[model samples]
Structure formats: C-alpha cells, structure tokens
Target: MDEFSFCDKSLSYEVRVKDLIDRMTLDEKAGQIGDTALGVPRIGLPKYEWWSEALHGVSDVGQAGNHVTHFDDVIPGATSFPTVILTSATFNQSLWKKIGQAVSTEARAMYNLGHAGLTFWSPNINVVRDPRWGRALETPGEDPFVAGRYAVNYVRGLQDVEGSTEDDEVADLDSRPLKVSACCKHYAAYDVDNWLGVDRYHFDAIVTEQDMMETFQRPFEMCVKEGDVSSVMCSYNKINGIPACADPRLLKDTIRGEWNLRGYIVSDCDSIDVMLDAQKWLNDEPYYCLDLDCGYYYPNYANTSVRMGKVKEAELDSALKNLYNVLMRLGFFDGSPKYEKLGKSDICSHENIELATEAARQGIVLLKNANQTLPLKSNKIKTIAVVGPHANATSAMIGNYAGVPCRFTSPIDGFSKYGKVKYETGCGEVFCKNESLIFPAVRAAKKADATVLVVGLDLTVEAESLDRTDLLLPGYQQQLIQQVSSQSKGPVILVIMSAGGVDISFAKDDPNIQSIIWAGYPGEEGGHAIADIVFGKANPGGRLPLTWFYTNYTDMLPLTSMRLRPIESLDYPGRTYKFYDGPTVYPFGFGLSYTNFTYKLVSSTKTVNVKLNKFQHCRDLNYTEGSYKPPCPAILIEDLKSSCGDYKVKLEIEVKNVGERDGSDVVMVYWSPPQGIAEAPIVDLVGFERVFVGGGGGSVKVGFELDVCKSLGLVDFRGYRLLPSGGGKFVIGDGVLSLPLQINFRR
Candidate 1:
C-alpha cells in the first residue's frame, strides 16, 4: 500500500476517496468497516471511531477512549431534551430542526475540542410500529409521514449552519461540507423488543413485500434522499430468512442500487455475530477479528466473505468509498476549520434550552379537558395537591439515552409557585407499587382545590430491554389512580409520563378526572413546562405520537410478527394507525387543544392524464429524484428520464380557531385507499402542519402539493414504486374535508 492524494484537500471527494483506497492493503481496508477503526498512521489517518450517540444532546460516549484531548470550554454534560416521543408530539417541523441543530452544535463543540467525532447516530426516525416496542421513546411515533418529515427537517438542521453564506445554500448536498453527519438507524421493520417468548434479536420477521416497502422502509428512503442522511445502520433482526446486516436485497439492492443512500452502511453492534451464532444462517468458519482494538468477530467474517467469492470486492469498495466520502466532507484530513471555530459553550447554550422548553410546552399533550377544568385560576384554586411517584421524580422527566441535565424539575417543583402546593408520595416505583400511603394521597386530593396526579411508566418499565407485558400501567398504579380520583374533591388532572403510550381508559371514564396530560418524559424543563401549561402560560398543543392501545392490544398480534398489513387468512390485524382497525384508547395523531379549530377545504382536485408510452420508465416513487429506474414496464419512453415530476397535485385548506380560548392544532393530511386493495392500509398519513389560531378569532390557509407518483399510489410485488394511473381521494384534517382523486396513467 502507498500514500496518495488523500490529504490534498483540493480534489473531489470521490476522486480523493478512490485514490486513498487504491493505496490500502486488503487487511488494512477490512479494518475500517465496523463501528471503530484502526488508523493507518503512516498515511496520516487517525484511529477514528465511527460510533457516537447524540440522541438528544452531546453525549459522553463521544469522548475519546484514550483521553487524547479535552474540551475545557464546553459544559461537562450536555443539555438533556425531551425524548423523541415527546418531541414528535409537538408536530412542529421547525422545532425539530432546531433540536437537530442544537444537538449538532453540541456534537461539533465536542468534536472541535477533541471530545468526539463527526458522525453521530441520532434523530432516530424509525416509525414506532407497535406501542409495545421498548424503543418507541427513541422514535418519532407510529406515522411514517410524520417520521419522514421529521427526518428531513432534522437532517437539514443537523447538516447545515442557519446563517451561512448564500454559497453554502447553493452547494448541492453532495458538494457541500457537512456540519456533522446524521444517521437514520436500524433500518426497515426492526421495531419490536423482547421479554414475552419472542426475541427480535433472533426472530425472522415475515414482513410482506408491501409492508416492507411502504410502512417499514419508507422513512429510510425519505431520510436518504430528502435529509441526505450520512449513513444507515442495519438492524439486529432478520427480514424473511436473511439477516438484516447481511441482506443484499435490503443493503445493496434497495439502499445502494435503488435508494442511492450515498453513504456507508454500518452493522448494529454484534448484529453480524447473531447471523453466525444464533440464527446459524452463516456457516461457521474461523472468526477473525475485524478490529483487534475493538475485538469484534463478525465484521471479519464479512471480510472473509468479501475475500472469497461469496461477497464481491466491488461491494466492499462501495462501502469503503461511502465511509471515506463522509470523512472527506467533514474535512477530517484537512483539519476542520468549522470544528475549530466551535467552542465548549455551544454544548448547552441558552438558545438550546429555550427551544427545548418551548418544544416540551407544545409536545405535552392535553389528552382530556372536560368542562374546562384546566388552566386553574390562581385566585379560585388556592391549594393544589401534587402526588405520585413521578410528582418529584427527576428520572421521570428524562427518558433513556439522554445527556445529564444541569438540574431536573419535578411535577411538585413545577406546581409549587402556582398555588399552595401539597405533595404526598403516592407510589414508590413507576412500575412497582409501594403505595402504602394511598390513603394519604387520597386525603391530600380531597383537601386541595385541584389534584395533579403524576403517574406513568419510566425507563425501568419501558426502555430498550423492557417491553411491557400489558398496556395497563404496571403494578398498583391503576388502583392508586382510581383511589385518588374517587377521593379528590376538586378537578383531577391525570398526568401520565412514559416514552410509549399507556392505557389510561379508567381515568378517561372517571368524571372526577377532568383533564389528562400526556407528558411523556418531558426533559429538564418538564416541571416548568407542565407548570406553564397548567397555569395557562403556554397553551397545550402537543398530540399523541403513538396510539394508547386498549389493554387487549397484546391480543391483536404476536410480538414477533413483522407484518404491518393484515393477513385475512390468519385474522391478523395491522401494526400502525394505517392498518390497525382495532379499538384504541386514543388514536394516532389525536390530541386536544384548549381552543377548537375548524377545518374547511378551499381548493378543488384536478385530474391529469399522462400518456404512458411517453413516460415508460417511472422513477421509484419513494426513491430519490432520478434513481430507481427500470421504468414502468408497460409504458414506452420517448424521453426516458426528462419528466417524471409531472405527476404531482396540490390541495389547499383553511383552518380557524372556533373556541374563545387561544390554541394551536396539527392538521394531518391522509389518503384513504380504494377499497379491495389488500396492500393498502385503511388510511395513511400523507402530510401534516402545525397552525396557530388566536383567542376567539384567527384563521390560516395551508396548501399541500404531493407527488402523486412518488409519495402515494400503487406498486408491484417487487417493491418497484409507481403511482396507480388511477388516482384517489386525499383526506384533509382527518375527515373534515375530502377531495376527489383522479390520475390517468394511460398506455
């Protein structure tokens, strides 16, 4: 191996990476594919670790393993923000972008100060398919459209500086310098976690072609092309009979061939090992360590596979090129001028905290408010009872995989300044019951003007390794809630906190439970944010990210079943809001605002006819702009790649606040498929927007222009995406407005 023009700084990324690769020995090159890498110091390459965890803030995992350098100016710990579930509840894309920016800011600050690297595994955009999935707290909720939009907005913010020169904007994604690289992870239908007889780590998910393409893999496509996500991490499970980390159909055909991810592919920790050991899909050969320093066994088998005829060396080159390409964009070899300019003070700036607070304020859903019992009038409500395990809990506010906050606020702390606050330890554990003081909690509720019952699942019951057995709150929480609700003399506001949805049907039925707040692990400012909403300092606008399933949600399907669309043969129900027709405690995309908002469709749908012969090759609908072209097989093309953008339509709608109180609502746009299409879900979310209306009066009209060919329509079993030449109705604001759907794909 010989050194080349890798540090030249003036060459194209592709050219430089190719030149750099040309100089490496096969073994030296094999060392670079895993999470951590060995340095070719002779060639000036530093030992770089590709893995960094910045889910909600700059994490300590980014710190150097050897203490090679230190960041003195940056805060010791990054600011912990609300979990993605709570963040998605906001339904505000711009806010998501700011969060991405904040996280990137902290990440860059660490990297510049030698605390971290440039590639961050963050903004987990996986669509929460099942409420039982332990990592739902890490994802953006059940709806793929919302998740995709979040992916794009977050990537945009994470990748670029807000006030850069116009030249920066003009630079196409490929040619531009990245602030930091963002990863969209555990790609395609890797949602479920273990505990109940089925383990996702070794399960073979029988995902159908339609479910695989539409529901599971859709967000990754959006992240790749729209967000230009830097890398994709394969999952721990197997799709069909193939391990995700080794599936060429998924990693190569879909990601590289069709989706044009334009970045490296990473194996989830020891995922490749599971293929050889547990799944036994790969034949046992002597396992060689990919990185001696890292001691990973499976990546070497992948290396062996590449050296032998099983995996092509060209594929290895592609993966290597993608990884090197990202490093080049980050200017790692050139010494980052961008990184140097960033300081430790950027870790948890005031602006970051402010944005997070606003996000928490908006994302905390007001699930129920009967007879307007909320926004307690301070003069009328002199005494407030805040009681529960979560009332004064710090960990309850910050969910899993978060940075340590400078200080955390609890519900009791949040409500203290609002009234004469009285707090009683109602329960000891979020999941277990140590409710010996249940009588005292009831007494406190009966004595106060209003009772804020803070109760819900925490990390112990709902995080990575702990998928709950039932939707009901664990232990005696339900019993405790009912006991306190029955005794409360005044309005009872049930505040449930969890990353995943919980069944609070009992509280919903109780007339004494006048209001319910879904404050799913609202981070550092959770207390203040909750206080703000209760005091009317901030209107509660956040909505449910995932459905609050009925207690029998477990009975609907097996935890290991990968199907998102139903199988009539087995009486299988679907996974998400789109396919699941089962009863829900609270529907996906459902939320309550203090003020009522009315929606009206103002624009008419138009029909467009395209001659099939003129457009024979259709771009894969969910794939990138000009990629994924085998063309619609039935059609012939005169101009093969010139005009695929001709299949879009626009719809406009007006929204108004009808209530006397001011509030905001997230207007969701959905598409109901033509009946009898077994592949289609009952309704799929297509688009959404957050709108604000004034107290008693205010209106705003919004328009959505959808690519009929790209976002919606029909496809063959091959996952070759193409719009149904015949169009269908696009529903706006749930069912408030519906328009005609008409598209003619004529041959």
Candidate 2:
C-alpha cells in the first residue's frame, strides 16, 4: 500500500478527489453510481446509499427506500412538517427556510445514526403547471418565478453553513458541519401525471423552444444559479423527442455547457434504464457516449458494461468528476471532526418541533370565511363537534412523503383544545363509506353548539402513482356534511385536510356551510395550528398557491394537453393562472385573512432609449451600400428591444391594514404587456413580496427594483427577451393598487 495525501484535510477538494479516484479500480467506479455503493475497504471508504429522502423530515426505508417513504409510519415521530404544497401556500420564503433548516438538521441526525444519507432528495421545485398532477402536492404551484424564489431560499436554508451566509441561518441544520444538500428535481418540464393513455414515466413532451426557454426551464435555471443546488435529477419524461436523462442539450449543453452548473445529474429512479429500453437510444450519439459512472447507474448493477467501446473514459471521468466534487465539498473524504459525534436526542429537538408548528400555522389556507364565520370566539361558542373520517385519523392528517409524526394531532384533538368538544369518525374508508357511522356523526353534529367537519382525500386516494378520476370528495363525507349542516343550530366550519384543490361546489352554494379551510395535510403540530386559527389565537394568513377550478373545466380540459400559453379559440382552456381566463372557485393568490389590506402605488420608473431615434441615427451614420455596413451596433438584432440588457425598473408601494384585525398580505405584482406586444401569457407574475401589516392602525412602505432587461422580459419565438419599451402597467395588491411604469433607456 502507498501513502496518499487524499487523507489530508489541508488539500483542495479537487486534489483530494483526483487522488481518491485514481486509487479506485474501474469496477469500483462503475459500482459507485447506484444508490448503494460497495466500499473499497483498502481505501477506508464505508458502504453507503444515495437513495435517502428528507422531503419534510428524514424518511428511512431499510433497503427499498422510496417504497415506504410516502406513508405515515409512526406516532410521536420525527416532528413531521407540513407537505411541500402546504409550505408553498404560505408564500413566506422565510418560513420555508426555517422549515428547511429543521429538516436538514434532522437529516444530519439521521445520517449520524446511520439511518440516512447526507445528500437529501428534497425541495421539489418543479413548477406546478397542471393542478391535476397527482404529485402537485410535491411541488410549488403554477408560476416558475415563485417556485424559483422558494427554491433559492429553501435551498440556502437546507445547505447552510453556520456562518457562511447570514440570510440562510435561522433554525438548526447543524452546529457547524455543512447541512444536507437539497436537490431541485425533475430537471426539465415535468408537471403532469398519468393521462391520455400515457403516463409521465414515458411521456414524450412536445414543447416549443420559446415556451421551453421562457416558461418551464426558468425555475431549474434559477435553482442552479440562485440556489447553487448540489444535485439535479432528470425527469422521467422526454423534453422534446429524447428522454431527459439522455438529452445532451439539457444535461451537457444547457446545464453543463451554458450554465456551467457544477452539480451532478442523477436519473430519476431507473430513468436511465428506460432510455436504453423504451427510447432505444443505446446506439445514439449522446446516449452512446453517456458516462455510466455519473450516477447514470443501471438498475441491474451491471458494472461489466464499462468495458464496452460505445463511450469514452474521458467522458465518464468528466461526469464522475462532477459527483466527486459535490462529495468532496461536503467533506466526506476529509473526515472532518465536526461530523464524528451524534445522538438520538437530535432527531426532534424542541426547536425543531417549534419550527414544525410554525410551518403548519403559516401553511393553513383559509379558503372561505363568509360573514366572519371563523375565529370562533371561546365565550360565544360553548360546544364544538369535530366529525369526519379525518377527525381522528393520523394517516389522513399527514399526507404522502411525510415523516413519522412526533405527535399526531387529529382534528378531534385540535377542536377539543377549547373544551366542550365532541368527536366522531363520519366514515370508514376514505374513498368509500360505512353506512352505520353517518347517523351517529350527524347526531353528534346536531347536538353540539357548532360543528367542525374535517374531511378530504388522503394518500390512498391520491399519491405517488395514484390518480383521481375527478376532483370531488372521495366518500359520503360530503353527504354527511350537508346533513349535519342542515341539522346543526349554529355555524358549520368545513375543514379540508388535503393537498391539491378539491371541487366543493356543494359547500360553496350551501349557505348553511359558513366557512372553508384548506388545512393541507399540516404536520404533527397541525392539530394545534388548526386549533389556533379556529379559536382566534392565530390569524390565518395563508393564500392559495394553486387555483381551484370548477368541475366543468375538468371535463373540458384534458390532462394530456401540454400547451402552456393560452389558445382562446376553444374558450382557452389553458393551463395555470397565467394563461387561463375562465372561472375559478378561488383564484391564484387568493386567501381570506382575519383582516384586510389596501395598497397604494407611490412611484415607478423604467429604462428607455434617451437618445432620440438612436437606432435610425446609428444606422444613418454607419450607412454603406444598400444596408448599413454591418448593421448599427446599438441596434442589436432585427429588434432593438432585444439589445437593452441594461433596462431597469423601480417602484415603491404603501400597504396598510385596512381591515379590523392585524395580518399579513402578499404584495403580488402582476404584469400585462402592451396589447399586440407578442405571444405570451396574459397578466403573468412579475414580482411578489409577503408584506406584514398591523391591524386597525398599522401601515408599512415596501420598495422593489429590478432590471427590466433580465428580470422582466418576453421571449419571442426565437428565444430573445423583448425588453419593455412602451409603457406598461404593474398591477399591485392583486387589484388594490395600480401604477404606471415610465421608461427611458440609457443606451
């Protein structure tokens, strides 16, 4: 054996990784790509697995990890935080960062105990284009920009070093060691579930280049550039005509080439195998040249394939180098003393529990509160009835990808906090009904002073591979609600314990039902959070992350349609809040708080060409032959608007709590381009801020400034961003305020 400097902590990560790889046999290199890595004992490396998950909290499966990750596995468990969909609803990136810290801290604890890995597959930042996606709960909804913002803050919080950056440290991820890495998932366009006789697993997405650049790919780019994400997993579906794992433009060109991202690209669970089998790209140039050791691990663990002449070792080493860089940066090989010690008590520390509670409090979206039906004043309400399948059911309380709850708090426990609470399971099966339970549930509801009906779908009804036939509630719970509401003498509060949007037209029309709450599979502390909002202890400030569409739209809009931009001819059953213009039960960015907020636009400015007819003047000065010598340098391309990368925008706005109670409001900045400007989504999201206001008498002024050329621009058919030239209006506070943007370009 020879002495090597790879063990020296003083050496650079590149130098250390080079030494480590040089010592490994070809068999070891090929074997290391899969989830499970067989250690080379000679090098002092230990056996490890890459398939660990920490979606909300650390999830462990003995061997077949993903198989058990999405289920509720324990009580008094890992301080189960709210699902990703719930986190997105808060529209509070700061809160998300806190949750990220808690999760990564627990992740490190798990890693120390040999139960989890340091590299966590989490913070699924895929833009939610279609609401019907079974895994919409796994992603932040609708807008690419919002998702991008969430990705950056959340990733920073997750991968934070104690004193490295001031912005990403709040909750405890680690005392000093670098936090567990967060991966931005499904690299390209991955937004749908099973549809059109084709599942997402093998779906070939046909997308326009302009839409691809300006729309779907925006969030992934932001995740890399802003978040500095550690890893990126390719999607199961094909982007244009090739599988995402094998698409060189996406992997080598866009990610590795254009953006120069340093992260490793992992194939989404056996995606590489599909590339070889279904897509049949075994002989194709890019696929043929794929580096098998870059986590392009074959499912069968056939390392002998490295001997094939299809690909170059240089390519394999280049790809493997990226993975090695991430591992080295994480301090895996250096064996820093900071990570040597750990204990079981770190799993769900008190601070971690508080963070979970805060997440649930912020994630609870108050969908409807007609006539101020919520905030059940304790003195006025003596008796409360909590009735439904989810009233006491732990599984329904926490949705898929949930950690084992440290303490499962059911609706029964929540409503009972105020005392004089009655509870009953209104149904048996989530998707079906037991005839016997409804009668007792209705009787309990009628006898109580007020009824809190907790009902909605669980993972059984919609999860990993589960797809719903419709958006309606699964069981006789709706019938129970109507019956109980008709009989109850007081107001009935309908609390939905689910992730995605559900059609509740029956409750919407029935004046008997006074309030609606989308609890969104809130974590273990969910019970307490729901109770706080209901009892007026905590004001509900969460807004809808995705739109709630009417049932009729489901029939008209097929799930298979991939067109993101609007097509108005067929009544424009377009996807997402940006494109759709039809009726929605609750629009995107909609939520009812205990208070109201008013917005006033103070001022705004934009950049426009100050030189009078600068393009024509430059053309005349450089005139030669029939056309200008080489075309005006200032005139950019065919469109002068494309050249103005210096275009800037600035604005200030005042937000006051106009309503009675203190609350927070999301200052949504929606933008509409000048009419006949170009083909784009109507009134898309430009910028937003979750601003807080004091109740009855509080007001605060918030300001924002962005480069119009890069921050806000329209990509044409050729992928050129058209900077704002003509005057445009910025809709502030949804409809509370409107401001004019004046422009003058410096160049």
Candidate 3:
C-alpha cells in the first residue's frame, strides 16, 4: 500500500470510480468518450498523457527535466499577461492573481520536468466576435465583463489555489501538486466570421435569448461561477445545430447542472470528431448549387459514413468520467505528484533571458505619442536610422506559441550596437522575401537624425495557420512608411511588429509620424526591447491587445452579415466596442503612456447594495456627482466584502496620476445588462484597476460585485448555461476607456 496502494486494481480513481461504474462495457464507455488515445501500458495505472497546450508556455512532449524557457521554437514563454484583452484592462484581482501565480509557476515548472499534467487549454474565454478572427489572437476582448475578469484570473492561475502565494510564501495549494489543468474554452458560442476554417464544422450559430443571455453566456458564467473552473473545452463552432463537443445541453445542463462544475469536460482539438462528424452527412450547398439540371446532392461526407454506435452509453460515461476526473485531481495515476519537479533549466539563463526581456517590456503598445516623438533623448538624438521589414528580423519578435529563442536582437541589431546607427531592409521580408528593401530604406531615412520605422506582420503575413487576407502593410510596407516619412529630418518613429491587429490607419493618421509603437510580438528580447524604447531607457507602457481594424479583410468582414447573423449578432452592443459602430481603426482598450492620468467620473448605477462585512475599502463608495454629467462616470460601491459574512453590490473608483513622470492606469469598470435581459455594451466591463501615478499625484480605490456580474447561459441551442441579469455599466478613460483625462502636469 505504499504509493497509494498501486492503483488498487480495477483501474483506480479510488477503486475505479464506483467499481468501474458497475463493470463498464458500453463499448468501453463509448470508447472513453471518443476523442481518444491510450498507449502507455508499460506498467499500469499512471500513464495518460493526452497531448497538451497551455496556449503560452507549457506544451509538453514526454517531459524533460524542468528547463522551460524556449520562445524561439515558437510560443513557450509564460507570464507576459495582458492579452485576453490586455489582461482585461487590468481589472486587477491582484493582477489576475499574479498572472495565476505566474501560470502556476511555469506550469509547475512544466510538471517538475518530466511533463504531462498542466493541461492548459487556456484563457481563451472566447468573445472577440470578429476583428477578423484568426483566433482573435486567442481571445479575451469584445467584453463580457472583460471576458469574465480574464476568466477568474486565468482559473486562479492554472489551478494551484488552495491558499496560494509565492514570493510571500504560504502556498499549500493542496500540499503542492497541480502545475497545470486549467481548460475553459469555446464550449459555447465560439465565434469567428471568415477566411473560412469551414465554420468549425458546417456552421450553425443562431443565438438569441437576449443574445444568448447577454453575449454568449458571459464568459461561461465567469468560468464556472467565479473561476472554480477545471476544464470545459468543446468548440469548433455549431451552437444552433448543436456540436460544441456533443452538447448534452452543454456538457450536462449548464456546465454540470447550473455551475456546480467540479471540473473535467474536454473536447476541443478535433472537437469529438467535430461531434461525430456533424451528425452524419451532406449539409448541401456545394457552393450554392453548381446545378446539374435541378437535383442537388452529394452525400457521403466521409468518416465511414458515420454512425459509430450513434453516441450514448451515458454520453460516453459522462465524457469519460469527466476526463477521468481531471486525471484524478492531477495526481495523474500517482508518480509522486506534488508538482513532481519545477522550473527546469538546460541553460538559457540570465534568468531565462530576463524573462524574455520582461516579456518584451510588458507587451509594448503605446499607439501614438504625438509631438514628443518619443523617449529618444540619448544626448539629443544623433543619426539613427533602423528602418523596417521588421528591422533586423529573426522571425519578427517570436509571436505565436514561440519558445527556444535566445539570440534575436535586431532593429538592425538593436540600433547598430548603440550609436550613430543605420540599417535598411525597410520592408523587404514581407512574409518571406521581397528584398528591394524599400530603396535602401528610403536611403537610410534620408540621412537620418531621428527615425525608427521597423514595420510588421510576419508570421508569414499573420499567424495561427495564416488567415489575415487584409489589414494591409506588406512588401511595400505602407509605401515604405510613406517613403521614410518623406525623408525625415527628425521625429519619424513607427515600430509596429505583429501577430494580430495591423492596419495602422496609415501610420495612425501620419503627420510624418511622430510615433506609433505596437510591439505585440516582442519576444526574443524583442530587438533589445525595441532598443529600450528607442534609447530613453524604457517607459512606453504598452496597450492595445487587439482591435485596430479600418476596412481590411473585405472592408471589415460581411460574410453575408456574418453567416446571416445571430449568435445574438455577436453580443455586447454587438461585438467589439459594443457592436462595431464603424470608424474604429484603434479601440479595444487602446494603450499608450509616456506619462499622464485623470478619470474623476464615478457612479452610474444599475445595481449596488453592499455590506459583505463593511465592504472592503475602495473609497467606501456611496456616490454624489449628479449635477448634469453623463459623459460616462461611475463608482457606485454599495457593500461588498464577503468571506461569507454577506453584504454585496459594489463598484468603486479613484485613479488620479496627473503626470509629469511616473505612469500606468487601467481602471475600467463596465456593467450594463438589464434591458430585456442581456443585449449589453452601453457598459460591459465590470471592474478593472491598475495604478502607479507619481510625479506629485496618485490615487487607487477599486471594487466590484453583484455576484460578480452573472450570465452563464445557453448550454443547449448548443449548450452550457447561467442566466441572471441587471449587471453592467462602467468606464475609466484617460488613457483608454475612451481616452480623455489628460492628467495635467506642472509639478
């Protein structure tokens, strides 16, 4: 009985979960619920490594001793947080529980170095309807309370919570085990309008019960009622005609009978053979009738003409005992378990190249700086050219699941190793090789004095198995940044770099482009962190996680109004910026910061009551400003502070940094759902707070509650549900809520 009694025979989940459900054999529980695989019987009981992908770090191949820092082998660095819509515009739950404890400390250091545990299907709480979904850079935008508070801090940072804490120590996360297993994706609604990936299996999408309980069941009802999430998957699109992984009214009456979700559902990744091949057969329309004299038909459609035991067997023994109860609570057949190893290393040091150069200087965004051109001061700029075709390229800042990267450096080797630099290849390597290098990068920005340029899109012109048919900029690199900003004499700057969002409305309304910087890919020390933000030695701040479109992929996708529109016409005022009202070439938590701040507006109220033990401070909100200010101000906060004492209904604010120097502000709050139950977007984000405002000013007081804004619906037009209402409204703009606050300086 030593190692947990060697699997107590009959395949133990403690004696085969109720004696193998009374001696199984319903086709071996419908072949353990299809999407199957087995193979490791060398010994017994401990070998179920079903392929993994934590969406950003933690992809395993039969484990290696912990050494996890790759980034060049393509996508494997962790904790770059913010994306999933800039970490849902920092509505900080202590920065998404320290980015879910740095993604369960790099997925328990990739399962203590031998791998196969941290399952991570990931924080793609899917909502970004159609900003040309090439997998909306793996979602978290087009709000549902900012994808349900980034799916409850990424499912409490890849499931390690049991009283977690690191750097501060305390971590008993169930005696230190779980270094992965945080699924939650697609499951319901899963949207993406075009460039046809054949609509996840013959498209169905019709949605509406108030846009399916307000925007696709609001982040799967905050990933199973406030992130108790363990696994959910199920999507390759099909909602109305039912598919989301054999939608048994969405994995059993709303993620296990109305959010009692105790974890384990899994399917996405060949979504249960696209739900047994979208129920056996020819969905007609072979490109709208190639008419052979009126009698259209094509039948067969492969997969042994379907009917592999037409489903059931208690729905494949409840999706194989909900994926073997998440491999028996991640002890995965007992091989010592408690995070077995940790942060493995094979070399790539200097603290994993300084955590991929501080995750490329925290996902650099600064969209437009305006007059100050930007940081550059290094003794008042002296002859630096740099130019584009992603400057020195080495796979333009390692985007997409990148890893094995260590030596990248480029913007012409980070500005010719520092001084009087000059390099061209302007826009040469569009996706592979164009090489005219924009007339020697506009003759080295016509004898430069100040010009950075760089330019983007190169995962061979947009990634995730390529799809971006438009969002411009390629080969010609926007006419070589309008011919090197018409041969700049000073201030040209552009930077760009892609993986998503690249239209750059002509260098954001160019005026010889004073500055633009987007940096989304920035990995292998993203060109020495874009030459330390062009020499001023770091400060850009980074924003815009996705949404910079302006008519590219067929004038912003129409695909017959997105397949005859309906998944609630893609909810939230109808998708991104609350139902695309046009004219946005930049918006979606847009970002930029050299320095500035101020948001004052607070309290609009749709709900607030609070007392959960004297509502934990955030300027103990009550409200007063009612004299004729409707430009979108909020800060309700009635009483939330529950540990179970009870007293809820909350919202609160105060951001103030009035700039001259120190910066950082996210503060967004959006809630609004009550009208006929949920068509949302006059308000959607529920709360967000991120601060740091020195230079003689500062403020912070944030809060939110109302069962943290509920929704969890539709587990059966294509299944999964939770449907309460009356929760929505919030805005914080002053850098990005709507962008106004200015933060007056003069210290």
Clashing residue pairs, backbone N/CA/C < 3 A, model 2: 76-406, 77-405, 77-406, 608-744, 608-745, 609-745
Among these predictions, the greatest lDDT belongs to: 1
**For residues 1-747, what per-residue lDDT tens digits would candidate 2 score against the true structure?**
237766776666667767877887777766666666666788886665666676777765324533322223222357678888888888888887877777776666666655567777776877766666777777777788888888888887888764578445534221223566677887778766565456777678888887787778888888888777777878878877778877788888887667656567777776666666666765433362233222444423333455566555555566566666676666666553554564457767888877877787887888888899888888888899888877776766667666566777776787777868888877886764676788888888888878888888888776766566577888687888898888887889998887668889789889999999998878777888888888888888888888888767778766656677665676547777877878888888888889877777677774344333445233212222453222222222234455445445778888889877878887788776544444556777777777778888689988887656555566666665544444567777566666666443344
How do the residues 459-532 of candidate 1 rate in per-residue lDDT, one tens digit apiece? 78877766777788888888888899988988889988887778888888888789999898888889889988
Model 2 whole-model lDDT (C-alpha atoms): 0.71
Model 3: CA > 4 A from native: 1-53, 58-105, 110-117, 123-131, 139-189, 192-232, 235-238, 241-322, 325-333, 336-339, 343-417, 420-450, 453-484, 490-493, 504-520, 527-747
**Model 1 misplaced stretches (Cα beyond 4 Å):** 1-4, 61-74, 163-173, 285-295, 298-318, 614-643, 716-722, 725-727, 745-747
| For model 2, the run of ten residues with the poorest summed lDDT | 628-637
Supply every candidate's count of residue pairs whose N, Cα or C atoms clash at under 3 angstroms: 3, 6, 57
Model 3: residue 424 alpha-carbon error in angstroms: 22
Query: What is the TM-score of each predicted model, taking all chains together?
Result: 0.90, 0.90, 0.33
